[model samples]
Target: MKEKVGKQSLKFENAPYIIGAASVAGPKEIDGPMARYFDRVSEDPTFGKDSWEEGESEMVRQAVMLAIQKAGVNKDDIRYVFAGDLLGQLIASTFGIKDMEIPVFGLYGACSTCGEALSLAAMTVAAGYADNVVAEASSHYGSAEKQFRFPLEYGNQRPLSATWTVTGSGAFVVSDRESEVCIKGITTGRIVDYGVKDSLNMGACMAPAAADVIYQNLQDFDIEPTYYDRIITGDLGKVGKKILTDLLKMNQVDISDNHMDCGIEIFDNEEQDTHSGGSGCGCSATVLAGYILKKVSSGEWKRVLFVPTGALLSTVSFNEGQTIPGVAHAVVIEHHEMSKGK
Candidate 1:
């Protein structure tokens, strides 16, 4: 008789898995001939304007509600809600989930909020502490520009590396059931400061942080490039993505075509003229929630690694001449075979 290796177990007794995800946009609220200018003050003439004010919590709420509905779960069933935005104090996320009646945990990871929130949500379900959890992030051009770039009337010229703020929101629900989509693993980034001089260019500021975490993740998991189907980076934009590629190569890791950046993929970089490309909480969130999740569900890919990049800097801090610190959180999403058809 063949020797039995310990007891073979097919069942995975984890907390739960990611069942569904959804991303909602306010119909491209601000778009026009002069929308490129940061100082042009014009109301976002859109349908959801009443509830979707710039930098308001309503947008986040709408996205979360839609995610809950898509997951086929009631809001009351969610044990925990992890949400965040770039706005001060994360007011958008807090107020958005207020009516859900679930325990809400606020977070601020700049553009990386989505990944951070998702990691926490996955942990909650994986640890058996929550049956269902939600992670969400939102950002609006009008509000983000005013807070980070310039006032409506300032009319300041943007630098070549500056990124545009995306107006949208994305959310996901994790539960205790086998599903087509699942969270495989996550690597949290350590706060890194390289003493960069330029604050306006976020790519240069956050590249080091992304590199450190990505390296650490590879080291910890002992995973090779061929092991994963895709390695996606959050909002590092074109400039930062290039830097990261070179850095990874130095460590004998080669990720070329399989590597993608949410900032560059979200919009038509050439046509949209988004400077270095899109960078914001919504950039990665919307792309993953709307596009990637659907593709994963369709069985096009088996394993995916998501690294959301964040530039931990504020206008107040920048004005005070403080160096910008950066962080990135890596989350692995995969398909669970046993949970299929359940």
Candidate 2:
């Protein structure tokens, strides 16, 4: 039987390394002169869909194909595909992978699905149940706004904590090969709730979860903060990132210089007009697929930890006054021996 991480046990299987990864983004830049927030909508015609329903699945499909190609793996070699998105019922992921000719397992992790998918995919490959696995996440602004907040035509004022939805998709291919990036270790988070009532400020709601998992990952691995070249968090914006730093200090762990957050790093906060930071699956996905993967391939940084955090509340659940539940998963990526030699 495959070894599983028990609820309270820190024991875990070392993640099989990530061999390949890729990301894609919508053409319309929402931050430019044509920006209208909600009124303008996405005017980019490349989406090729009249509405959210058609475009989301297309983005997911494109991301998966790119990842598979980059990984140098054929579709027939992928044992299983694990994917998710912010859309209701994971419409983007389900429809996107339907024709990939590989068995698929659908997941729902709100905005944190990217890390969640990677964690599970690494586990599957590491445990030897499969030789190759594909994990991916995608999101679009139109569908997310319509489903989570309001209709496009509603034109409601957003709260200061409301995060700008990102338009992009990211995918990764994990395999047993020792030539590319290796998955080091993963730390899974428990549901945490501190009675924070505002869903708009998801950073506040999810920061604790990110901190908890980061602490546990270090504890579980018996590694020091300095051991990693960088420690990255998925989508905690400015406020949440601060909260996470403070929380880590409480545990005697300092990740100051080498730490970065995807939501904060993806776009320039001042230039992009992002009030706090970026959010959604695309936030981390794009960063990993675009920036981090290239760095790994180039041998700029050898070892890094990626923790994607998620707020597990939905529109209906939030409307019913349920407190937000949060979770995070950590994946370590490093250059392999063969790659480093080259």
Candidate 3:
């Protein structure tokens, strides 16, 4: 019942079931390789909204409602909703879910907000504080570009390492109710800065944090790369995936074959001119909801180590020339096949 693991990890005694999940992506993402998996796609990024910010909020709104609907539950069934976004004040989430009337825990972990929310939601359910909880996170290319970097009008040339901010939202219904997949444990990450200052290069900034959290999770659980069928990292893109691989290999933990980056899987590198790949809260959120859990449910993977990485920086910090600090949280998800083995 203690559930406490090593310093930064927790072992849940009663793992919460991931009852349902839904993802909404923009037109660009709909054209990607994982498009078929997404529950819904917005033909236009605006979704007929007045502003891109409002459009981003609408994405979150639709995603949460779809997730709730897919779970066959009403809004009243959800005890709490943990959601977040890359917007300045998390307005994407606040304005989006305010109508749900569910008590909210608005989170901010940059791109890692999805993992943060999921971990917290699972904790709430495991602690018997809530029967049903919804964890949602979103990002919009237009909204994030306006807030974090130059507008499209600026037409600034992007560096090869630059990643596209995905316009999408994903929501998950986690509960004590029975489901095909469940969260077994969680490893909370610490903020780590390697003096990365390039705002355009998020993969470089976030990789170190992903490595740190994954290594800690492995040590805490005393497991090797072979333990999980897949070791997935969120939004690390192509460059960050290399960095994370190198860091883990240096620690004598080789996970090259089993490791998969949501950023890398979400797009086709050669065909899609996404540069390094996808990056944003939506990058991992939609991938997890749309693809990762699907694999679990289908028994394509018996167990998975899911770690969502984040670059914790703001417009003010970037403008002030502060280094970008990275953070990542690890969540252990298991299939019933592995449940019996464990």
Order of candidate numbers by TM-score, starting with the best? 3, 2, 1
- Enumerate residue pairs that collide in model 2: 17-182, 17-183
Write the residue-wise lDDT of candidate 2 on 1-342 in tens digits.
Answer: 334343422233555777777766664434532222111123452367666756777777887887788778898999999999988888878877888889998987777788888888887888788998999987787788887888979887766666767777888888887655777666777778878878888898888998888887777677897778889898898888888899889889898878888888765676876667888887788778777766776778888888888888879998999998788887777766674544
Which order, best to worst by lDDT? 3, 2, 1
The number of the candidate with the highest lDDT is 3
TM-score of each: 0.88, 0.90, 0.97
- Model 2 ranges off by over 4 Å: 1-15, 28-46, 339-342
User: How many steric overlaps are in each model, in order?
Assistant: 0, 2, 0
Model 3 ranges with Cα > 4 A deviation: 337-342
lDDT of 3 by residue, 1-342 (tens): 489888789988989989889999998898899899999998888988998899999999999999999988888999999999999999999999988889999999999999999999999999999999999999999999999989889989988788998899999999998777999999999999999999888999999999999999989988898899999998888888899899989999898999999888888866888889998999899999999999998889989998889998999998898999999999999885443432
lDDT of 2: 0.77
What lDDT score belongs to each candidate, Candidate 1 first? 0.74, 0.77, 0.91
Best by TM-score: 3
Query: Could you tell me the lDDT of residue 151 within candidate 2?
Result: 90
